[model samples]
Target: MKFSLYVVAVPLALLGTVVPASASFAAGPAGADGGAGGTAPPVLRLTDGPADKAAVAVTRPSPDGSVATVPVGDARLTARGPSGGLVLAPARSPAGNGPGDLAQVHAGDVVAGPTTQDTPHGVLVKVAAVHANGDGSIAVDTVPATLADALGDAEVDATVPLTPGDLKAKPLTSGGKVTAGAGPQGRGVRLNVDVPVPDGVEPTEGHASALSASLDLSPEFLFSYERAHWYGVQPSRARIGMAADYQYGVKVHAKSSASYATGHKPLRIPAAEVNVDKTVWLGPVPIVLSLKVDYFYDVSADGTIAVDAEEHTDGRLEIGARYDAGEGWSALSGPEPVSTATPALITGSATAKGGVGSHAQVGLYGSVGVAADAEPYLKATATAQNTPQGASASWGLYAGLKVNGSFFARLDIFGTRVLDKDWELPPLRYEHKLAGSDV
Candidate 1:
């Protein structure tokens, strides 16, 4: 396994010309013109190839010919070119390239199936090159010329055989990867979606019910357009898209600063930077309030603002501050912006009772701003649970009252100050199709 982290930032001023070059750079053309754009190459990978004793074998070798096979450990793969794409040439093909360079491993030395299998007239050989996925996974590029001719009507029982796929050359796209050859553009309608607001702005009642109050600064939506013929056959070209989605804990965008609609120039931002600073109050109470800011633009476009906040936990990490990391989160009590977290992602609430003075909780904080001492006594508690993919967590007894208010508004003053005390609940329903699909 290889770990790589990098920050890439390109000003929109010169992005117009660099955008198209990014695609061409993968074609492996020699020269400064083919030098990659803002994208970074993958790190070199070294995996233990299979043993020679378990090496090549011809599934059905051609009756007459026999190709040589090298010992697994003897003939290993090594980086040879600046590009990360995989090659089938010898190790020192380029002689002396540094790390993250082009790599090569021969088919004959394959620890996989036999390098040359028996065929009717000649042997079926594993030659030529291939590309790998972002994670160094094999992607068959072309089938060997001899092997293709020997197979005739038969096929190689592989996920991606060179026989059926286009045998044309492909430009290496990444380390161990390439841009598969395909035809030109086909005529079809294209739908592009990009909401300027980092967090989508929901329409208010009539004009607006909940106005998103903030100096919105994130291009937080997706922009993809697929052009398929509405009448005849669908186009075979790959859909062109740019995903400036959220990362770490910040929302990334895709807007040319000068213009929201037209000047939507291209900008490539690699890794986001995080800055965190905290202030601890250790007087009669021991509590720490931290401030964190995510720098999207060069400077601090926003800061964490803490208000009268008090939190208590048995064992956890909690802070009160307004963070402007694109996910518009307001401070606990301080208000810099309204809630901008997306809708379907999360919905949580908690209620505890049994004579402990009942406590109901609701929060969409963290990304919000800071925590203030609240003039006097202050207490805090922090809790965090990282749920892995496909995991499920359920809470709530399906009974209780949920309300929020400041210290000034007494809870007793307002009834359950509960409405209808009825156990009946209305139908909970919502319908939203993936926006990418056309109406």
Candidate 2:
């Protein structure tokens, strides 16, 4: 199997254009013109055998065997007749130059399908030169709908024939030899053994052969032939091993940057990601669920020592079930996000997320609950910590449209409102692409 990853940094300015079901109709056509303001119609030219002519008023082909011609513009053509009627040819298109060029012309360009639903009568698409193989039949690449309509129905089928018979068959032979001593149930004893001729019986030189034993000899040699090196201590302790991984990435938005204007440099809070997954599955089901913790450091723009905060994360906890739907699949879920803070000095919020899925894909996920740390700690310090701070909860919805090459993107928008107030926040935006991968 092969894997690919890429990062697509779409400018926020252009997000509205491709955001799902969110674009406005007022953008209009990339480019369109008013009816009379549009460019004039293209010129039309026609020709017939042994004579070429130009005319504006032209007669288009009709379903019935009848003919009609009229003037369209200043030019005119001396009307000539074929065995059937004057077969006005199709127009040429830009992709190529030939009779077909016009035969498929639609909107001043060569097309393979009908460009318009309607056409006037007496219009005939011009055909290439007619060639007859001395025998009188002409070579043709395509047939007109009128001719095909007249021919009616034609039947086609594969020439190969099918043979019928019963598909089931018996095996060449019934069950053969079964190993008697194998696996955990058998103590690994060999059911068959090879024997070597006694040392003195090798005098005949005509034919010599050898047979080999299947089991290793080093450990068993002393226990069977020597028997003198036996001891009592068989290691009694079994070593156990464990492993884990955890992944976390979060974005924090600032309420406003205008408050802290002059002294400090603009703060850059790049997304924080922490991944920890722990597993201790020595044999079977009911493996111990692992817990992972993450932390983020956030600071207020104002140079206030009181607001430089740290997010002590309560890592996700996940437990996998034994049964599953397919290979590389598992039914598992994670614990919610929890934070550590003291009520006396800090006020913070936390969230929990968990779902069951396999690999890097999430089949189902949802929020379990929200919690805060240091609520009592904040109440005690409220008199001294006067930062005029507020907090509220908000969520966003997202839907992915299509995959483009290696980039997978989705459109999502969020709204925030101050609790118990009319203040509404502009929708928050987010987009992410797979950034990298390892072998």
Candidate 3:
């Protein structure tokens, strides 16, 4: 007698909305100068040199809107026309000191002492008033002191309001050094400073922290086996039989968003897919099978202290068998159970002071010639500790899969078993991790 079987299994369709990538916010621009005369207003420069070399000389703005002071030690102040330049010399006497102090100038101001060539015609330094705007912008009223006749005949006084569109920012260096400089442009001044937020994050008055997170789908796991069995010791009575295969893995569609001092936005990840298919011949019976798994996940971080995650899974399997001859083939089994909904195997959250994780396992069994098991897991953790004199915060997320299974077949003649065997496949595993830190 000759027989054949064919099977086809379809898994459930994946679900859930994917969050869009974060939007990038440009740094505010330097405010326009409100002075007349078409003369380019004098700008402040870190006479010390490039930001990397003069980092220590430049101070950063605080959350309280305090001024970031920059020393004017021998810094040169060049204006547009001839005799429109002056050197920022230190005050020689207490009476010669500007409103603020000696050599030191606030973030948005330019200060200088009496000129070396002419004490009476030396430049006077006027401090600037810095304000933090509600819409993530900084405004500065750069009151350039009345220029001495030796430098310029005009009084360069103006209230320049710098907006987020007015300032330009550069990437932070390894040492957290920010580039700082200011220059005059068409009766206006341009100020460049370092604000340590990621490209996509916007920093408002109260919020100024950076955050990033992600989720990924790993490769699938599959196993297959084949063996032959003989019927009788006769030449024409000889027969070959027994072949099997097994496979299982999930495709993950996930989205993540974060809320911190900086800001919040949704980030999306492409879906990952894992599919398995195999064919086996049991004597004159031929069997074909396939399986698929799909799932969705969402992760969010609230402030700098806590994180949460949630997930759902829709799994499916299909098996079909048929008999094939030289002329045609006959169907032995049709696709019935189209899909299966599997509960989330693992879920959990973590905090800045500790870490948490979860794990879950599932099994699949079939009579034709296939059986297997799968384990999926997720873990989240955050660490905060003192390092000698400083403290640091670190967070991470980990996920992966592990699978193992077997394939077998048996035959009997006249109530006597003639052939029986099984093949065991080794376990397979895959894992991924994402991490970030702040000090």
Q: On a 0 to 100 scale, what is the lDDT of residue 12 in model 2?
A: 12
Taking all chains together, the TM-score of candidate 1 against the true structure is 0.17
lDDT of 3 at 33: 39
Candidate 2: minimum summed lDDT over ten consecutive residues — where? Answer: 217-226
lDDT of 3: 0.24
Tens digit of lDDT per residue, candidate 1, span 1-439? 0000001121212111111200111111223231224111111111122223112222221222212222112221222233322222222222221111223434332212221122111112343455654643333333433221111111011011111121222222221211121111111011111212322222222332111111111111011111112211211111110111111111211111121111221112111111111111110010111122111111011111111111210110111212122232222221111111221111122211110010111111111111111110111111223586654433211111111111111111111111222212121111122111121
C-alpha lDDT values of all predictions: 0.18, 0.17, 0.24
Q: Write the per-residue lDDT of candidate 3 for residues 263-323, one digit (tens) a residue.
A: 2211111111112222221111111222332222222333233333322212111111111
How far residue 37's Cα lies from its native spot in candidate 2, in Å, is 77
Error of 3 at 26 (Å): 73
lDDT score, candidate 1, position 142: 30
Candidate of highest TM-score: 3
Lowest lDDT 10-residue stretch of candidate 1: 1-10
